[model samples]
Target: MAAVDAAADLLLTAARLPDRDGLVDIAVVGDRIASNGPASVAARGAIDLGGRLVTPGLVESHIHLDKALLSDRVSTTAGTLEEAIRVTAQAKRSFTVDDVRGRARRVLDMAVRNGTTAVRSHVEVDPGVGLTGLEALLPVREEYAPALDLQLCAFAQEGIIRAPGTEGLLRRALQMGADLIGGCPYTDSDPIGHIRTVFALATAFGVDADFHVDFSDEPLHMHVREIADQTVRLGWQGRVVVGHVTELAAIPPFEQDTVVAELAAAGVAVVCLPATDLYLMGRGDDINIRRGLAPIRRLLAAGVPVALASNNIRNPFTPVGTADLALLTFLVAVAAHMGSPADLRALVDTITVHPARMLRLPDYGLVPGCRADLVVWECARAEDIPATLPARTLVLKRGRVTVEAEHRVVERWR
Candidate 1:
């Protein structure tokens, strides 16, 4: 390595860039991938990745910063979604800024260390807590600014219509630097009113809308249809996100395909929060226990972007999580019965490119001139990467090395 040039900060030699052939060299110039040039490049430093797979950094589309990591705080004695909500609501009443920050910090450390370069977290904003969670989290966004891109949605978990004064708090959060407006229609006294209020606020703030709609095992609650209608009516196409439309799984395939097509035409992206849903939903029925996921295959077939996410980590809603994207992918693969190699390869996109597309992240791929937010995996093929969940990896943010893990072993038998 020669004395580093000011313009070119680093050179990566023999790093197996994904979607490209033949162990090429990559250059990073001032936080951007410069070009795929000769291996003998002039830069300050060089890292020979030893022909490992270099991939775009992971993206977490739907996660909760405020209500995460609360598995021990409350017990889901009944083990139901309503019970989870009750417990979480009770816990939020005692949240101090430090408490919220501390919990959120743990989630961030867990995510960034595992190759997630971008996270869109939903922070609760309602009269009960009244912007305290967002107040605690805004600084965190600044704290991790150098390492990852964090976007906060002013989420109303308690339902805007049911929780009076919540609509006002959501507006305040958006004005106070929240990036998106969030809603949960099912929790509302008026599901339609809930959707209307949240979308109106999102439009008023010129921000995006992310909603938790139709999150039931029954097919009766079809708020997702109204959400799509509202998205088009507001001219908010491609700017709307709907999460946890699990009821689509129960609807007939023909009906599900029709709705998925409408969602696709409306340009609304869907997020499947498997971990929390798996734990919270399907606990009521004994016969024909539902998988309780969005119709992912049908959605993809209908040209809708459905991204997978770790919705909650070790909380009442979800009791187990390692905060690893690979683990999330693996669970979804098994739960959704995606067994084929092509299906597994498609699973990779739910955590990576698909979320990037949903979030519309600029400079967010492995191409030259993109941001150097990338991960280098120990595995050789992308399909094998998910099975090797949380493998030994190197993480780079803006062309700088941020996290590097050689390996881990709990028990080895040889």
Candidate 2:
């Protein structure tokens, strides 16, 4: 371990339950949490959280940095997924390493300010330009590792296994120190085949798999059955993740329950990107509207591990968003109809422990010896977060203040 400046540390104090009561103090040493309780620990500095809600630093399980940082470029007027893809494809050529790095850094700052301490951003690695994008973002990942845990998904936006030379690209990305493999299978021509091949390669390479299961509103686009069968056959039940199975919203209630059970038994986690889905799915004509969100309620009821994600940033599907996992939680609670107190706690896991599980994070929560990544929201109550979505007053990444709460003190001019 590298030596840290002992003089540049802090002691945070409050008086309440760390999760809800809005009064909890956390102590930070260097890059990990030292203590979190009612103790007046001596330190170089102390921050008074003043009865605000203390929470684990946010974690964005799904995000597209390549798509998100492209906000400043040309805009997509059609507001459809296909059009957005086309626009992004046209703009990819102009994105140099410097340009991508700069924009991604800016977006990271936004996320940091918004209390997101960990992010799993999907950087496109397909279409030849993906490697270039990854090269630019790798340093950013390392730069923030001490303060924030940043995981890059060597994402093949196209079909992974079916796309030409996809395996080679995946191999190259892993060689470049990428942490995981990503894919968009259901959208591909051979969804099942693509998923199987991707999963196979992931297992062989000893990497984690996070793939898009289905993004469409159509009932036929779902892949839960195929994924279950594949997991059992390949013996990769606990190692795979499928995001955005929005077709669950269309399936009958009984069918939804059955599928949820199957997914749980398969040991697969379902990631629901509520904000992105709210922007993309279920568009219709006169007097008929469809909700394109995944069946988060039923999935949770069946005890399937479900995580919430911020899938896109300033892309066609979701043109405006910071990597605030809390925002995803807020929107998901409303869309999924999970409003009870118990349900809210479960939903909070979507942004905290659930995503940590998917990312295979070694340690999480405010436990002893865990990394000191914590956040203090300005709100007085935890459940009130969904309605107000309060600003994060303080953000500590690995026991360091990556973002300090702003103060607006008024001094008398007398």
Clash totals in order: 1, 6
Residues 1-414 of candidate 1: C-alpha lDDT, one tens digit per residue: 232234467887888765656786778888898876454567788888888888888999999888888887777788788888898899999988889999999999999988989999999988888888999999999999888899999999998888899988988898899999999989888999889998889888899999988888888688999999999999999999999999989989989988998899899999998887787778887997777888888898788988999988888888888678888778888898886777777888888998998778899987777999989888776777667664747899999999988776777575
Using all chains and alpha carbons, the TM-scores for the candidates as numbered come to 0.95, 0.90
lDDT of each: 0.86, 0.75
Q: Which stretches of candidate 2 lie over 4 Å from their true place?
A: 1-9, 18-25, 407-414
Location of the lowest summed lDDT over 10 successive residues in candidate 2: 1-10
Error of 2 at 156 (Å): 1.5
lDDT of 2 by residue, 240-306 (tens): 7888898877878888888888889888888998877777776542255566888887877777778
Colliding residue pairs in candidate 2: 16-23, 22-51, 31-398, 32-372, 33-372, 314-319
Clashes of 2: 6
lDDT assessment of candidate 1? 0.86
